[model samples]
Target: MKLQLAIDLEDIQGAIDLIQKTKDSIDIFEYGTPLVINFGLEGLKKIRAEFPDITLLADLKIMDVASYEVNQAFVYGADITTILGVAEDQSIKDAVKAAHEAGKELLVDMIGVQDIATRAREIDAFGADYIGTHTGYDLQALGQDPGGIKLTAAEEIKSANPDLLIIGGAISTVDDPATAAAEFKKLLG
Candidate 1:
């Protein structure tokens, strides 16, 4: 029942301000792909320094150089780093290993890939800590539904590996949080 608040499009100060404002209310604080790309790992470090207790997720959307990226993220204070589910098996394994070595978690983001079953299986095989069923900003902007992807991926992953963690994305509004929680419950059952 963790609620991760994604911070995107804002500058470092703005992100810091938002996190400071919402830290007590949110379970996890996510640095969105755009913000990470714009500010780099330093952005993650800054947020971590500001909020030491909150779980910090860096949405790097890593596709290659898995070990290096994971190491860099961990060094910069990311408690969890995200890689693309569509990435090569070796890449996923490398990232997962790196994350384990650093005592952090890896979240495999299933963005464009439609075959949730296969991707979830692959990520689970690699021992990823969490699977992110995400709707990218462009998709959300185009009025796409996040529930379909979230439910499909959650069900597929739970069927394959009941222990795996399923994280829903494109959740910003208050209503979406309740919707996501209900969808997760249905999938778990």
Candidate 2:
């Protein structure tokens, strides 16, 4: 079980500082969609330079041009990059291939896919290292909890592909990330 700290701040320095402060508590540092969109690969480069030993995840939520996007993420020093579950199967395959070529991992983000079980099965067959069920910030703001769905999908994936990682991307939405992460670790245990 790994605790990933997702950073969505517009300020790269602030994100870096937070990662520096919370480095010991989390295993992976995720550069959220907003942070990636706001600063592009430059932000990832800076963080990689600052924390060379930490695992950095680029949450690009890539839906198309999988190879190019995944390659760019790895080239910029991301240890893991994300692909959208709603993307075409070919795109998912391409992303996985790119990740393999880069010697990194691809996490498939199931953010908007309505059929959780079916899509989870399908995406799990795509050979991604991790399958993540995410509840975006807007949904979290509306008080919607996706933990149940996330756990369900995780169970399904674990049954089908026990080695594949199951990621819950809503920890950042929780009030206390450290406590939430600890609870997740306990649950996994």
* Regions of candidate 2 where Cα sits further than 4 Å from its true position: 147-189
The global C-alpha lDDT for each of the candidates, from Candidate 1 onward, is 0.75, 0.78
TM-score of each: 0.77, 0.79
lDDT tens digits by residue: candidate 2, 1-189:
566667875388977766765666567888888988899988999999999999999999999999999999998989999999999999999999999988999999889989978988887787888987777767877888743324345455445543333343444545555565555445442
Give lDDT: candidate 1, residue 170. 32
Clashes of 1: 0
**Local error of candidate 2 at residue 57 (angstroms):** 0.2
Best by TM-score: 2
Tens digits of per-residue lDDT for model 1, 1-189 = 455667776788977876665555456678888888899888888888887888888889999999999989888888888999889899999999999999999999899889998889878888998887777767878888653235556656566553434343433333345455445545554
